[model samples]
Target: MAEDRSEQEPARRPGGRTARVRHRILEAAAELIARDGIGGLRYDQVAELAEVNKTSVYRNWPDRTALVADALATFSADVAPLRDSGDIDADLVDFLEAIAAALSSRQGRALLNVVGAAHDNPDLRAVVDDAIAQRLATLSQRIKAAIETGELPAVDSHLLVEMLSGPVHLLVSRGTRELTRADAQRITSIVLAGVRATAAQHTIALAGEHDGGKTPAARP
Candidate 1:
């Protein structure tokens, strides 16, 4: 069944009719990729799903690999970056919750499937890497913004995002644990504390520098 289109319309491509045609191809590709694993993806299936002719698929993608690459890009675009809502704690919490929700979605699972398939296919791996790179860039920017505002500590933002999400990935991928609300809270607390502690340490060090690195006299 064709999924219900969201109220928000996709932006029009500069190519007018050709743009709509390409968008339909991409939409069809996303649906097929979600339904079938990356290895099972076929341009013919995409054409059938998009309700377009095979010639259109060929003209747009030229090959199965190109089709897969474009499909993965389309899928990546759907997973928008984590936003900064000004409240660092709330933002991080929301981000974690969103991760859980996304991982449970068909599209999210399909992303992992593509990752696995990319392991053997070099070209596909590049496509997957590019998608992941885009996500990581978004995450890194949010982390940096938080740090700049003193909402988070001075740290490697990329590493910090990974640290925050490492457990969530393990939980979903390993099936060792479920991402309960409580778990999300606990993860947020731990990360917040770590960031705060590091920031505090840095502040104390800077204060000491102003005091000429001298130890204060013992209090009575």
Candidate 2:
């Protein structure tokens, strides 16, 4: 059986058709990566899935690594962006919940697939790293907002985000259990408590430093 892009797609983009084609091809590339992992990707498959000419795919991304990189980057950038909804607890829970959902999804598997293959593919690895860093940058801003609003004390935003994300990533990737809302609540509560405790410890240390590093005298 022969697959025809024209037969599969009846409609066409009106303006900036080249851009539209690039987007469709990239989307198809992402889905293929999700379904078959990076090693299984084929240009013809991407073209057929995208309903564009195979030449279009090649023209847009001559390198397979470039194709895969663009696809993953575009997909991650399009995922839901985190927002500070005035409640740190609620927002953190919501954010974690969203992350759990993503990790359990096919796209999440595709992302992990790319990450797993990154060691052997330097170009793809760099693209994936850039994408992840960009996402964490957004999270860093949210943490900053929490700090400025007094919802959280001065803490390491990157480390805080890491603490908040690492456990969930490990659990989900290991297939231990699909995280539920309850899990979200538990994780959020524990991390917030730890953050507060750490902040208190830092404050105490600073206070001691101000006292010329001397032990505070006990008033009888």
Candidate 3:
């Protein structure tokens, strides 16, 4: 009725402005969280850092948990994503390198600290657990595929991930030294070799049982 003001206004593409605003708010939230942990994130600070209206933050995220969850989710996706390149060794080395890089960053360390203290914060615990589970699921899938292709022995994917990632986390958290590509390679090699050898022994043991416990030398 107001002289068709809608038509007079510039056509706004869907999710253009809204998406940019959401991205900015999320980035600001992550930065603040990285600098000061979860307790330090404030809407005023987020609004100021994001350069968006304070109402934008309020309208987008219902509460601190929601905002933190989204920020962590986005951070996880960007930080460390496991990829399978049909070569398990190289793939694992790359994955480990990514982990090292992430842990060395301010954002990554902040997120890890949040996770470390998650036991004290139920809301943060739930969010961190969910994000971690999602990432592990991806790693599990890649490990499963490698097993199927005979690139890896049949092993517990979760344990395998723990084995591979544990060293990186330890080295980075301790500030012992910088993680190098050689370290990633050595970790990958040692773990994979152990897994393969274990699988081989298991297979030989099963074969012995099937052959009435007769050793190869004892056979005709």
Candidate 4:
């Protein structure tokens, strides 16, 4: 019998099987969470849906919170991402459009349901908080960069994000109609204009205070 060199080789490349299993598990978990609130998620259901062993689920995630957190984190990263293309107007428009699209997606609705139910579930609340924080961090960094580069006014980045995303959420959640590119552009334009105007007013106010509450022409 010749030596079985094939048997000596690894069954699969390192991390390949593990990655696939994790992906499937996460996807099944999201679907289940979307269908049934986090309270209804069961390891056996996840295992069966994912086609993986129950032990694998437990081996990877010791508790439901960890599993849900990872699933949401993955969903946020995949579905809603903010990009910086050096054009603040276009970037903001694209970002608003992405948010509208995501909010209208299946997973996005799932996330909204989780948020609605989070008030009663401490574990779910924490998971949602963490996921939201991760998203805001990326958006905040981009807004701050724009401000530093003189592309945007000196405004609270978080507040700006809220103003920009608020309407999208409202429109999508209403289920009345789909958000259009024109809507996104209009939202971006209005918010940016308001921010710039506010910044200019603040600058004018500061200059007046420096001039002992006198206008530029009145100073002389």
Regions more than 4 Å wrong, model 1: 1-17, 79-85, 172-181, 198-220
- Number of clashing residue pairs in every model? 0, 0, 0, 0
The TM-score obtained by model 1 is 0.72
* TM-score of every candidate: 0.72, 0.80, 0.81, 0.80
Poorest lDDT segment (10 consecutive residues) of candidate 4: 1-10
Clashing pairs in 3: none
- Residues 1-220, candidate 1: write the lDDT tens digits: 2222221236453456566667778777766666677767787777787766767777657877777777667556655557778887767777777777666565565666777778888988888777766655666788889889977778888778888877776677655666887787888889878777776777777777899878453332
lDDT against the true structure, each candidate: 0.71, 0.77, 0.79, 0.78
Q: What is candidate 4's local distance difference test score?
A: 0.78
Instruction: Write the residue-wise lDDT of candidate 3 on 23-99 in tens digits.
Output: 87888888888778887889999989988777778877878888988877765676467777789899889888987
Which candidate wins on lDDT?
3
Candidate 4 structure quality by residue, lDDT tens digits, 60-133: 79988888887787756764567888989898888778877776665666676688778988988988777666
Distance from true location, Cα of 125 in model 3, Å: 1.9
Candidate 3 residue spans exceeding 4 A from truth: 1-13, 79-85, 105-107, 216-220
Off by over 4 Å in 2: 1-17, 212-220
